[model samples]
Target chain A: MQFFIEVLLGGLLSGVMYSFVALGFVLIYKASGVFNFAQGAMVFAAALSFVGFQNLGLSFPLALLAAFTTMVALGILTERVVLRPLVNQPPITLFMATIGLSYVIEGLAQGFWGANVRGLELGVDDVPVQWLMDSTGIGVSSFDLFGAGVAAVLVALLALFFQYTRIGRALRAVADDHQAALSIGIPLQTIWRIVWAVAGFVALVAGLIWGARNGVSFSLTFTALKALPVLILGGFTSIPGAIVGGLIIGSTEKLAEVYLGEYVGGGIDSWFPYMMALTFLLIRPEGLFGEKHIDRV
Target chain B: MKNVIPLKKTLAAAVFSVAALSAAVGDAFAQAKEQFIGLPSYRVGAYAAGGSGLYGGWIDYMAMINERDGGVGGVKLTWEECETEYNNARGVECYERLKKKGSTGNSVFQPVSTGITYSLLDKVVADKIPMVTIGYGRTDAADGRVFPWVFPMITTYWSQATTMVKYIGAKEGGIDKLKGKKIVYLYHDSAFGKEGLTVLEKQAQKYGFSLVLLPVAHPGNEQQSQWLRIRQEKPDWVILWGWGVMNPTALKAAAKTGYPREKMVGVWWAGAEEDTVPAGDAAKGFTAAGFSVAGPNYPVIKAIQDNVYKKNKGNMEDKTRVGSVNYNRGVVHGIITVEAIRTAQAKFGKKPLSGDEMRWGFEHLDIDAKRLKDLGAEGFMPNLKITCADHEGSGLVKYQQWDGKQWKIVSDWIEPDREMVRGMIEESAAKYAKEKGITPRDCAKEG
Candidate 1:
């Protein structure tokens, strides 16, 4: 039972990290209706840029600021160069452009900062929190706890922003129906640029925390693979759903791997989440917080 | 005022320039004493860090030889790089594109990837090209009687596995003291990752150690469940058979779970500076098996530094990586390649050797301790001799440990349990030959 709790908590913590990356995707998909495949590459570029600036002896805050500036520039560039031209095209075409954009972003990141793996120090010690361990005999990393807190704060702020902010509502209006949103004085282009800039901010935060955890490298892009399942389990459009779905997926996969993995030959954690998300998709096509849509004939 | 040339005149000039350029390129490639090595490199992509270091070292070593030795037996070494991005399809495409390059075509092929090695296994045999899989390839290809074309030289995975167990045994006082010890085999879940399982299982059975196998998925950035289970099991030791990001991730996870870094050991693929430096202090005290040692102190490295880098003709942008594990591993590749060509030159009168001729050279290659000293690579790479029946001349591994900054050699060259490894290789090769409807070569018949 003690070991089980530890695994569950660890899984939840891991899921929070997945939610960090997933939040970036939700912002773009919610606003523009285009599933940004380049989110992972953006995360990688952001982190690499942060590290590159730091290597040049910049303080952490400066590096963060520089990296955010780079990401925002990248987001604006994507708006002007990629998405602007593909406006009103099929969603698949938009998706393909993001895929191409992903390669270009990856190339640019590595090109600017040579492809070398570098450790990130966020000054958060990764050791188990002593008080929690002593009280409950369960090991939970303080670094992980810090990461979860950051994700939670970001989620709350984004949730409130979408619920109340004028730009946020306009962004939602654009997502609901690009044509219908355009009929109003929403200005789809301005709304998209704002959402993408916001998405870029999310990507930078995700990259720093994730990069600090798993040394920034080309494989940091692979974290995007985990977000796909999270997006499926949660709604692609739901900020809160990403968190809830991450928790569910994270806890379940770890628990399953711990208890049931030995009998099933182990290493099931990778594919098990995908399978669970597939099952969830079958039951709730619109997802837990995803808005349901119906076209009137 | 500017005057524009006529369309026909401009076209004729462009055509003549292209024709003249082609002629020069054709004449340069048609040289009798030129040896070509088409490098299927991955300078950019998922595994680019390691790729850059490795191909950089390889290209540098070849450059040094040409600069220092005027090429082996007056045969100038030439190469072309084709980016594979570490993808199997691109690797194969690169192989096909470069097979017919140079005067006598490609002398030998080395893909530096297990997936690419597997893809070109049968093709190399059919094409009469000898492929060298220095450390990672078909372990069973060590059985040269059955696999005459493939040389998984120096050390194979099976051998490395047993050598790792031997190193562990030595640490436990002796092999006899390893009875009933619980050893965890934490491996990456890919063909390259799982290559050590069979030998490890065999070692476990023989030594009375409890071997626990845990697999991490590909691009293994996440290993929470696996590490948590590892913490639960409280195994005596953990053997990390990982690659790429998997290495540092494993190190970080172990640190997070309070697993002692000293108790964990990684394979050669996980032993580079790139592997340890990324995990920061978490990688401290972590040990790994290595075929070639790191450090620029070796005379051969100094030679490259003086002859190549000093002259502004070096391949690596960062010259400090001259003695890194991957870089030196690339140098080791260069040594064996040049030696094989030299050995063939001794028998076939120098000049550029064909792929078929290079196969003969590889089969008969020998680099003794004296030869190594003469070449100034005595302690950098192991001295070995290849024969018709033994493709893997030696199965020697040096253990290295990361002490916060860089790797330090922890153990002398440890030889694997070769007799047991050879038996397994023969059995596997025999099965493979039977499956392919091919007859094994008799060692006596080979020249």
Candidate 2:
């Protein structure tokens, strides 16, 4: 029972981090209606920038600010240079453009950083807090508890901003119908730029936390790949769905691996979460919180 | 019209220069003045740090060889690296890409991944290309009588694991003292991690230690909870079988959980400057096993500096980082490879050796103490030999601790317990034979 609890907590902790990345993906998907395959690369880019600034002897707070600002600039630039040219193209073309954009960003990152894993300090003491009544009961790391709290706060703030702000209204207008939005004098281009910038900012925050945990390496981009299933499970348009879906995927994957892995030879933790995500997709085609759409001819 | 004649002459001069360059290159290839070594590296994947260090050191040593001694056997060695990115598919692709460019077959194919090792085992066997897998891959492949194509020198997973448990047992007063003690095995979930478990299990049965198994996924950056459980379980000791970025992170996690760093032991691959650098001083006192010489003061290392780096030919991005554990391992690899080539040359009349001849050389290696001293690798490794029965040239290892700065050797040159090793080898080799549909030679009956 104790082991199960520990595993559950562990998995939920991992899932929370994954949800943060999935949240970024869902935001971009809703705003542009284009699945940004480059989300992973953007996470890596942001993490590298933040870590690079910190390595330059800058204060952590100041480095984080610089990294966030750089992410904002990257957001605006990607929209202007890449998306602006493809404004009238099919949505598929935009998706493919993100793929090409991923390669470009990867190359630029490699050319500049020369591909080495840099260690990141989360600036939190990594000591464990033994909250279990008994000395031998389940415990949690201070780093993880801190990570989960910060993620919750970030998600809540983003939720409020999207619900109450005027820019958020414009974003919702564009999401409802780009043609309808344009008819009502909403500048689609400006809205895209705003959404892109917002997504980039979210990516920056996600990148720093994840990078702090994993250390800033090119491999951090893979965390974004793992977030794909999280987005699918959490309904790409639902904020709450992402968090809950992330926790479920994370916990189940760990539990299955712990109990079922030995029977199958081992290393099942890798593919189990992905399989769970696939199962989730089959059971609910519209996703947990995905909006149901009807089409009549 | 006179100006046109001068212009024509200038054009002719330009064409002549181009022709001359091609002829020079062609002539260079003809005389076999250069030894073309193919370096298939993976500097952009999960195992990038390790692969990069090995490749960087390899190129550096080769440059040292050329710049210091002009060349090996008066032949300049030219190498072009193809990036495999540590993927098995890419590794196979790289082998196909680089196999066509030389006067000779590939001198050495060192694919660090065990999965790649298993993949390339059959093809390289047919090609007779010698594959050097230092401290990795199928442990049963060490039986040269069965699989002569594979060379896993120094130590293997089986030997290392048994030795580590033996060391642990000794610390607890005796092997008999380990009864009922709980040992938690926290490993990266891969063949590399799985390879050590059979031997560990065998030893656990023999020593009466109960094993608690925990596997962390690859690119093992998120191990907070795994350690959290270890804290709860309060296992007597934790053995880490991790690689790449997983090492430092594991150490840092242990430090966070307040686990005594000395109580945790890592495999040889997990114990390097690269692994502990991220954790900094928090990783102090952490112990890990190593195969080769671990210190900075080897004679061959001195020669590498005097001959390779001083001449502007060393790949020493940071010259101060020379003689590091990984750098020394690279030098040791160079020593073993060059010695094998030289051994084959001695038997085959000293021009250049084929892969088959190199295999024979690897099989009959007799690197005694005197020879090691003469080769400038004194104190870097043990005087060892490889036989038809054992591709693992040496079963020697030492425990080293990360001292916040460098890996300081904490134990003497200890050979694996032979009775335990031989028994484990027979059981494992028998299992391998049954799985692969092959028969093991009965040395006793044959003799």
Candidate 3:
């Protein structure tokens, strides 16, 4: 039972961090109606930039600010270069552009910073919380708890911003119909630039946490795989759904791997979440908080 | 008219210079004896740090050989790197691309990946090229009679696994004390990772210890449940058979679960500076197995610093990594390869040899303690003696522990239990031979 609790809490904690990346996807998909395939690469680039600046002898806060500035620049450049030309093209075309953008961003980061895995220090040790372990006999990581706290706070703040702000409403209007939004005097391009910049901030935060855990390397791009499942289970257009979906996916992922992995020769954690998300897709295509679109022929 | 006349004369002079350079290049190629070794390297990807360090040291050693000894028997070593990006498909494509390049058409092929090695097994055989899988690839391929085209040089996975057990036994006072002990075999969930489990399971049964199998998926970034399970079982030790980011992640996870780093043992792939440095303090006291130690104290290494880097012919961007674990391993690889080419030249000629001739050279290659001392790599790497029947020249392993900064040698050289390892190799190789319809080579008749 203690072991069970440990695994369960560990899963929930990781699920929270996954929501951070999922929020990045939600922002762009909700605002622009285009799936940003480069979000993962952005995450990798953001973390690499943070580490790169630190390596250049900047303090942690300066590195963070510089990395955020770089990310904002990357977002604006991506908006002007990749999206501006293909504004009214099919959604598939924009997604394809993001895919190419991912490669370009990866290549650029490699060129700018030499390809070497660097360790990241977020000042939080990844050791288990001693009090929790002593009291409940469950070893829960303190760093994970801190990660979960940061993610939850960020997700809640974003949820409120979308719920109350006029810009957020304008962003939604652009998503519903680009021409309709422009007809009502909403700036589609401005809203998109704002959404991507916010996504970049999200990417930066996600990268720092995950990079601190896994070391800043090319593998940072693969966390998008987990985020996809989160986006699928939670609505891609829903902010709070990301948190709930992350919780569900994270717990089940750990439970299934621990309980069922041994019977299947182990290492099933890598694919078990995908299978669960696929099952969710079959049950609710629109997801819990997702809007149902009725197409007119 | 005057400007046009000058233009024509300038164009004529440029064309003449080009022709002269081309002729000189052609003449140089004809006059100089050159051996080309195909290097399917990974220089820009997830495993780039290791690839850079290894290929850097390998290139430095070859450059030193050329600068110090005027090449092996006056045959200049030439190589072209085709980036595989650590992908198996790219690795095979690189093999096909580099197969027919130089005078002898890729004298030897060494793809530093087990996945690539497995993909090229049949292809290398058909091409009559000898593929050397040093410390990686199929363990059963150590039986040279059935696998003449492949050399799993130095040590096989089986040897490493058995030696790991032997070292653990020595720690436990005696092999007799291994009874009733429980060990967790935490491995990467791949063909390369699973190779060690067979020998470990057999050893578990031989001794009375119970073995628990745990598999970590590729790019193992998260491992909460796995470590939690380790805490529950409280096994005597954990054998970490992982690669890339998985190594440090495992160490960090172990620290998170309050598991002792000293109790964890990593494989050679998991033991490099790249592995430990990333985990920071969590990686301290972690031990791992290796075929070579890391240091720049060796005379060969000093010569490379003086000759290769001093002359601006060095390959490493980070000169500090000249004596890193992966770098030293690559130097060991260079030592064996250069010796094999030297040995081949003695039999074939002082020129570029064919792939088949290189195979013969590998079979006859022997580097003892005296040769190692002469080569200035005595303690840096173990002695090796390749035979017609045994492709794995020396199934010797050295253990090292991480002291927060660098890997410290923990034990003297330990040889694997050859009697048991050889039996398993022959058994598996015979089955493979039957499946592939390959007739085992008669070593005596070849001589």
lDDT of 1 by residue, A163-223 (tens): 8999878888988888899898889888888888888899889998988888989988888
Among the numbered candidates, top DockQ falls to: 1
Docking class of 1: medium
Winner by DockQ between candidate 3 and candidate 2 = 3
RMSD of 2: 4.6
Q: Model 3: per-residue lDDT, tens digit, A205-292?
A: 9999999988888888888888888888998888888888888889988888888888998888888888988899899998767788
Error of 2 at A91 (Å): 4.5
Model 2 score (lDDT): 0.78
> How badly does each model clash, as a count of residue pairs?
0, 0, 0
Q: Weakest 10 consecutive residues, lDDT, candidate 2 chain A?
A: A131-140
Model 3: fnat (fraction of native contacts): 0.70
**Candidates ranked, most accurate by DockQ first:** 1, 3, 2
Write candidate 1's Cα lDDT for B1-447 as tens digits: 133557778899999999999998888755777899999999998999999999988888899999998998888999999999999999999999999999888879999889999999999999999999999989899989888889999999999999999999999999988898999999999898889999899999999999999998888888899998899889999999999999999999998989999999999999998899888999999999988999988899989999999999998887777789899988998889888999899889878999999999999988899999998998888878899989999898999999998889999999999889999999999999999987999889779
Worst 10 residues of 1 chain A by lDDT: A286-295
By TM-score, the candidates rank as 1, 3, 2
- Candidate 2 per-residue lDDT, tens place, B49-108, comes to 556666666677677777777766666667778888888898899887776566665666
**Which residue runs of candidate 1 sit more than 4 Å off their true CA positions?**
B1-30
Give the runs in model 3 whose Cα sits over 4 Å from its true position. B1-32
lDDT of 3 by residue, B1-447 (tens): 979988999999999999999999987776457888888999887788899888988888998998988888988888889999999999999999999988889988999999999999999999999999999998899999999989999989999999999998998999879999999999888887899998899999999999999998877887876887788889999999999889999999999988899988889999999898888889999999999998789988998899999999999887888899999988988998899999999998999888999988999999999999999998888889999899999999999999999899999999898999999999999999999999999989886
Could you tell which candidate, 1 or 2, scores higher by TM-score?
1
Worst 10-residue lDDT window for candidate 3 chain B reads: B26-35
TM-score, B chain alone, candidates in order: 0.94, 0.89, 0.94
